[model samples]
Target: MTCSRMQSVVIPRHFDYRVLKCKVSSISVWNHLSVHRSLAMNVRRLEVLDERAAGSGMGTGDQTKEMVPGGISSTETDLEDTDDELGMHEKHEQYLLDALSKMSHLESFAWSCNHSPISIDLLWPMLLKCHTLREVEINDNLVFSPVTNDESEGDSPNVAVAHELRAVALKSNKHVYGSAKHPDFTRVKGMLNSCPNLESLNIAYTQPRSLPHAHLSADDLFLFGRWPNLTSLTLTNLRCSPSTGLDAASSFLFAHLNLEILHLDMSPGTATWYNKLVFPPNCLPRLRELKAHRDLVSSLLACPSDAPRPLEIIKGVRLTQATDLQQSADAFFFNLRRHGVNVKRVELTSWHEMEDIRRLIESTPKLTWLDLGKKGNGNHHDRLGGSGASSSGAAAKSSSSSSSSHFSVVNANEWAILLSAAPELTTFHGVKFFYEVSLQAQASIANAANLPLYANGSTGNSNSGTGPAPGATAHVNLNLMNLSMTDRSRIRKNDETASMLAWKCTKLRRVDHWEDGGGKVVVIIRDCGDGKEKDKVAPRWEIRRVKQ
Candidate 1:
């Protein structure tokens, strides 16, 4: 579209007869706006050239030269014509300003690479006219940070206009936090405190902890004095210590009320330090979720030697490792138990074969959901002896019972204790076995279940029509993860006896197996309540979803 008698002009491709007379009346507008097609393309090429020169901290003029070819103006222009219309209703000047103030739907604002200072100075006045601004999104690509005069100490033009925003996001040019020796994040921090309605923030991939004057520690959390309405908070690489003003943060939450979620992603080594500070009962009155890496959980519960603090069942937790699995698990469980907190669901990951599922299960009695899958290819084992033994072992010597309960890394032995002890369990999950559990051993386990006593390969008809036998309710639900196609095929091929024996336990509801080639094999659940016990395939059971 051509403008009136401008020296440089971007002409419209089609000139209709109706506007020809109007175009001729303003020849100066055409001359002033006369921009050649080649010049526009050359300016586009300069984008990359400018980027390279900025990387080298060299002359921006040289970069601009590389942007345009021959006959290009060397000086930057004072005026820029973006020709953008107003965003909100602009029927009248007052109506437009009023619409801006009342527009609550506005969530983000960005002004990068669109206009320069002279044009920006005009843009801010128009934006400030928009009173409805809630969020300001400033992309740092187009010199979003203002050029400050050392002597005047004046603020950025956009910063002055951003006072009404509730949330501010400053996506920097790079992940320069902590790495930069002298970080200049003026606009970054300025917008943070500017918005009175600001409650949540996310600083993507920056090492803010390493900043000299602006770094925030756990201690600073108390300075804000508990935001009662604040429901969520997140921090990455925020350096914090166990002794750092836990009472103050807790007091803030208690006083203001209604705080629910807290997320801290710190150094891997010091991640768990926050767990050590126990929230006094009802301190975080509305808290429902706490998320941290495994290392953090370990650090929080590391000092089991100290008085156990009651950490109620948070809605969710993501653990990161298995090195201190049992200790961490025990501390988490015991802490929650102190407040009689019953978790409705718990999802945890481990690298080793979990030996502490029993303690974890018994601690969270209200647990309706449990997932104990391994993250990497690691196996963990629990201590052996009385605690791991079968019910009958209690009649034997306590020492024998202990030994029976004590899990051996040996393949067949641990299954014996686990199958017997975990009878009332609703959901049992584990990684695919590293070694195949023999069919004979598996059959023996099935025979030892709630089923009637029978000799090998023999139907015990002698006890036909007998009343319910002792301990007849023994049913275990099992879920398996990380099973390769080869491993599953091996079990199907090598352990026909075990599969057949599994068929005998009518109460077995579901078996989720990660069959190697079969993908995830979910054996249809079966209801084995029929009087006539058949040796054929178990019938498919119906699954009913009940609301909690």
Candidate 2:
């Protein structure tokens, strides 16, 4: 194709000039945009994320130099190489600003490169000038605090606010989550003032516990006026003063009845701290996805049985230990069984037992994704002995049950049984699952699954019988960090067992083996045959899309 034709076809209306490497030729979007100056007018969304310098190759006769106005051959522009990096950066910043001027029709803009010489404050007027712009996001990547309102405003004339903006997200440096240091609140307030009717807002601000700010509390989240269009709110790394009481955030939630998605990260305190903050029941009728602390899960799921929540995904982070879950475990699960009936995905960093997993699968029949937590140690024996086991027979039964139910790690047969309970589950993360380690156990599970045994007593599948199509592929990513080589070797992925699992749980696609020390290993079921011999060698791509 001709260069002009290629530009017309390849360039998208939504452009992301984000690069992780400093070697994107000129290390700026303008040099690349210079290649297609006409295409800039068509851009609707532009994201310049993690922008960096081009390093040593700047003065060379590179493609970027040829595409951009001032090349190495141009006598008008004098730029140094690695010896004078600052001069090159200054030249590129000018080029970047020139490119931004061309994108007059841009509707969405995001700037996340804190290291760039360009200040986000400088970009505000340029972006707000775009009459079509509606959404904006800024991520702080700098070492210092953000510019204050007065500092940001400087001597620039009063620019008209973007009343048409529908979404705004101002994020702080994410590395420090539980700290007082946050992005400049004054600048954030000024930005919020510009857009009053936002449909979505994400502001992560935390302050010292002593001098509590209402911005972290119920003062309409510091908005100039109510935002009736707000449907999604993500507030993280927040610590409201205890003196402010539990109603600080909940009161805000009560007012926003139209909210569909909410992700709140409060101070990681005790269960009592979590339990004290009640999730006002019979509210947020439109809530679809939720992520909050674990102790408050029961209350969040405490919506009326008749008015069950339509939550498709629910994620919880445990504040305390396993003993917290030991309280009314059955009833806690019963609530999940009720309100979570419509749920398709469950991710809990809270403690879980075999019975807990079993109760979960049996409850959420529509479940396709399940993530058990890594917080609890296996103390099943202790729980059994202390729960008042009277007779030896009961003890023996509890002993057998604990082996499958209580162990932090479980065997393949036990996993197969648990999987059998939820046939629809395709993706599973968390917990240690080992297959092909115990031959006797494998044989027993194979027998129970009614899998056909060959002459050698091997259960390797030959037919696709109502299974994954021929040459089908699945992707798994598991990280097994900080495990002894012996334990790691034991978890060696056996493809045959993975196929057996695929046959047992026919829809199974991906299994993520996540270890506590932040390791992952993914196992795929591949090359499943159609049981036909005529075209054994021909390759065919059979793709299937599962509904989420």
Candidate 3:
């Protein structure tokens, strides 16, 4: 049976041994038992979870015995009990090894022991035996030792033995309130060296913990270069040593031509203390997307020229300082245009000015998606032209006036000018449109439709309609295809915008509006008519609102 099929088959109690063995092709045996022997041997993918409860069990049986519930125990009695517990622990480890040895065709293995730290020495031998293994995950404060006996040995045994391994995840299972104990860096490096064709590696905290030493060192960054085929790498809370310069770090990362996606989180501290990354030209040739801290992005944008490879997407944490943010924003777009980078998607925490938005629109003509909002609630307060106070004043003025108002800081005229610059724009978030602008857009559409038709029945001269004026090009193709906004003004719940869209914005298909009371309304437009007989009957427009 396939792995997915095997997962869904629930075994009922009271089945015969033959029947049970036949149907039970895969099992996750938490503990070593005689009843699971037959089932365990047939299992191809196994996940051995830690049996330790939150505050309960100690690591080994001996350690468990040392922590007696009673106040104080005699040393002689405790020593005797410890020896007895140690013998039982040795037996238990042997039993586990013996059981794992039966699974000759095991493909995947995962072990998590947060409360009870498992010794890597006990698990390595059994893992080495599984030549078919492709993925391995070990978490929960597991202690690791070098796979080889010689400390001076250049290569480890696991890398040489696990030929089929493609993915490895090593993490701590520390509770939110507890301190994190990271796995040995040397052991982790050895594992990477073993899997030359490794594609994905994730080493991060399983929960929030306050342990600075647990962070990966700057020198460890070079270990990633060993895996030439690595496609995805995720590292959280990485620490940079004073000796390691940002230039070296950037150069090492740029050397990885095969890397496509990277997620990085620097150690939490003052941004100024962090070394600025210096990316040279033609770096990250195959990198299509990057998600990192603002400091890292700022350093990248500081590069003298455009990136050697075309970056399509960038997502990063927002900078809080106003001056630092403005400089970063300016540097980012300026470098993008100067380098001729063809980035089409962006997600930023904030944009301070309308000019910045305008310049961004002009720089990336192919941009199709944009998100400008705070991290949690997606509320955007930054204005296009003014400071926070000025933006509030603009909003107040907009609310009182019917003919003009500011939506997310852009006035009606400014919105038209800004939007007109982006030819391929679509899927915008956190930008509302004033009612007056909607009406104006509708009027432009009506004017375009009223223009004289040619003798052959095709659209006339581009400059014929009042919408285009004397020499200006008509913007009939400018459609807000997918719009996401919050209606703070709370205009009347009429079909004014919908009607304008039907008449002018022919290509607009969806609009998501957030109402005042934390409710959402999604408007979808569908054409419900056959393609044939265009002249005989007008096309039908169906507008529907789904409330959330």
The best candidate in terms of lDDT: 2
Q: In candidate 2, what are the lDDT values of residues 99-187, reduced to their tens digit?
A: 66777777787665645555556667677777778888876533125465677558355656777888888765533322234433444
| TM agreement with the true structure for every prediction | 0.44, 0.63, 0.59
Q: What is the lDDT of candidate 1?
A: 0.37
Q: Give me the overall lDDT of model 2.
A: 0.53
Worst 10 residues of 1 by lDDT: 16-25
Per-model lDDT: 0.37, 0.53, 0.49
lDDT of 1 by residue, 1-548 (tens): 25564423333321210111111112122222233332222111002121223322245543222211223242222222223434211222232223223323233444322222122233334454445555544433221233346612644445444444555444334423213333333434444434545555544324334443333344443545333345556555444545655565556545644545555565444445555555444454454555566434334333332333333334224433356565665566575444334344455644233345555555565554445544343333321122232222212223212222223212323443443343333443342221232234335434544343221112212222431243332221111123233333433332342343234432233332322222332232333244564333233311123222
Worst 10 residues of 2 by lDDT: 472-481
So what's the TM-score on candidate 3?
Answer: 0.59
* Candidate 3 segments whose C-alpha is farther than 4 A from its true place: 1-44, 49-99, 143-160, 173-184, 206-215, 223-225, 245-248, 270-275, 298-308, 317-321, 349-358, 375-421, 430-523, 530-548
| Clash count, predicted structure 2 | 9
> What TM-score number comes out for model 1?
0.44
Q: Could you tell me how far off, in angstroms, the CA of residue 506 lies in candidate 2 after the best superposition?
A: 5.4
